[model samples]
Target: MSGHIAQDWEPVVIRKKGVAAGQRRDEKAVNEARRSGGPIETIKKFNAGSNKAATSTPGINTKKLDDETEELAHERVPTDLKKNIIQARTEKKLTQAQLAQLINEKPQVIQEYESGKAIPNQQIISKLERALGAKLRNKK
Candidate 1:
């Protein structure tokens, strides 16, 4: 079966430029109209959904934000207090289901707690602290 493999020295013809078949459109008029436009005119429709990426991709770096985004953490509250719940659960080595079982609550309730949709009051907090052995409130 290996005898059919092409030789390594074979010349591979690569097309370096020009549009691909079934996907070419005229953009000269669009360029001319843009050249005559005034400044601050919103430039162009960068993302009208139907538009596909073409020759003009104006490169962008898409690395994930890796900074100490703690400054941006507050916004996650209510939508993110669930993080604290997850943390507490992990520290206790308990799954959401296990935690819910201990607390007489539904697994979805634990999810809601973690999602910041349901902030537990003193009673629930105490139950959680007992269940997970964590300090969840101010020490006053």
Candidate 2:
């Protein structure tokens, strides 16, 4: 009896320069576009157009806004409201995943609301109420 091992151990050829150069160019273009607050498509087009890196992407403003004039908007959803949402969803015998599908939202969104990690906007709240057949909003 003869024991024979079958194996194909061929050394792989690595062509780094071509692939690496392309990836580097793409990364550089994307970074430039992001820093300038320009659309990513602009980077793609710029890269497709020429080998030179663009100093500025036209039709994009790179000005910084003052914090005093910029108001950070946040919706205040009461903890009771979060409880209401969870209660209603449970009463309907629906999982957060199911509720998300019925309401056309991601499951993570439902989970976030239930866990009090997020306050959904008015539009989403309305959808949730309809799906769970419960009133989530407080009468004000």
Candidate 3:
């Protein structure tokens, strides 16, 4: 209520020829892929904009940083996470197939996640957290 203009505001400045963050993904559903697992439909949906009519679109299966790329890598749980996943899955009184259906994924994804062989993204963790009514991942 001072002498300040009520409508006083600053406008976002956009520089020409500048690419904004997350612009790298153009409706590829990359976030979905990262969260939902590598489903064939998701792959097709992402690569619809094929410059040269792509033969196949790399989906979640191809994701993850290899040894060559160690800039920002994630470390999978040695045993505790595997146990936690298994325990949580059991506590829900749900089978792998049922859990997959609940999370919109294949049974194999659930198996892999519990086996500690694959990294689960936020969506999966969120589902697990809700189903178990507890946090599943311990982030550092």
Candidate 4:
């Protein structure tokens, strides 16, 4: 019947169970050993159905290159393409830097193409052809 009713309030504390102290110390030691690159014992579980070869090492490159792939690996811009680029650029009276600016490319790119050191790029070749009014690709 009172305007305000009084009630008892009780505070309760709850604690969560965590890893045991010995287990935590063992984990810390294992982490430290891994960070320091020290050898650690690896336990391999027995699996009867695992088809993986036990003697094979992981991440080893076992691939052998074929003749075609080997040739492609050493491929560069053709000498003819380099000569054409140089000739067209010179006939236009454009310096390497000036031609590069006209094609919106770097001067080093023009130099590389002229020196036959650049890898063939069709898009850049097309841009150069349009800018210099010449055909740079080989005819089949």
Candidate 5:
């Protein structure tokens, strides 16, 4: 039985189509074109008609520009609000860090508010007003 089993068992060699011998046909063409300095067409082309002409120019009416500037001004903490905050905080004898702690905010937030760079937040402003005992909004 052992001699019969030895005769039946044989080594099998499995060969897989080894990685397509080298560079693929299309890749080789691209590489050759690069080496030869031939102009290869781009995959995407700019549509000349799709681009819109510049609407706003120096000679154009600036009402729209003024409206945009006003909108940007409204988005940030007002300069007067910042000044009021600084004055109130100073009058209360509190440092920026101390005022921030009192209002449950970070010192950087207080710094941003004082510098008029803070995005106006009603909740934070309310907290600041309460902490400083001052009105901080809509003061001309």
Candidate 6:
């Protein structure tokens, strides 16, 4: 043909490793890694001094209020409720161990109530009442 000779063309290669091996690569992988906390190796690779300076404000307080504590302080079992449980169990001829089994509670817990060592929550009191077929609360 003419005075110029034809040259064979080859595609340009931008990456030699990772997903885009032997082809063109972009910042997509790097951007994703930055947005999400990337692999462990990448996380450990960074030691940016600017990050510490950026955290100047103290973190928010996440502790919730103690509503249960306040409510229980006022909703205690009546002083004579334990006596009622003892009276009911005696009338039914059921031992503390048997009563505890009926209510799905430990025998020692029943003992604690009889001995006035533990003031159970409302749920336990309700369970005890159901198991003994008695009302342990004072009639008002």
Residue 115, model 1, lDDT: 73
Least well predicted 10-residue stretch by lDDT in candidate 1: 72-81
If both were scored by TM-score, which would come out higher, candidate 1 or candidate 6? 6
Whole-model lDDT values for every prediction: 0.66, 0.80, 0.70, 0.83, 0.82, 0.75
Q: lDDT by residue for model 4 over 1-140, one digit each (tens)?
A: 66888788999889798867534446677787789898765455676578577646654444432223534365689998999999999999999999999989999999989998888888999999999999988897
Number of the predicted model whose lDDT against the real structure is largest = 4
How far off is model 4, as Cα RMSD? 11.7
Root-mean-square deviation per candidate: 17.4, 17.2, 23.6, 11.7, 11.4, 16.5
TM-score of each: 0.39, 0.47, 0.42, 0.53, 0.48, 0.44
Evaluated with TM-score, which candidate comes out highest? 4
Error of 2 at 26 (Å): 36
Candidate 5: worst-modelled 10 consecutive residues by lDDT: 51-60
Off by over 4 Å in 1: 1-81
> lDDT per residue, candidate 1, 1-140, as tens digits?
76787667978799889866433344654455568672322246666776466535544322234433555432322433456568889988999899999999889888767877664555766788789887665544
TM-score preference between candidates 2 and 5, better one? 5
Ranking by TM-score: 4, 5, 2, 6, 3, 1
Segments of candidate 3 deviating more than 4 angstroms? 1-78
Q: Summarize candidate 3's per-residue lDDT along 4-96 as a digit string, tens digits.
A: 667868999887885466344545556666686654232346555676555356554456434346566676645766787788878878898
List the candidate 2 regions with Cα displacement exceeding 4 Å: 1-73
Task: Please write out the lDDT profile of model 6 over residues 12-62, one tens digit for every residue.
Answer: 979665655323234666566658776422344354765765555535322
On a 0 to 1 TM-score scale, where does candidate 3 land against the true structure? 0.42
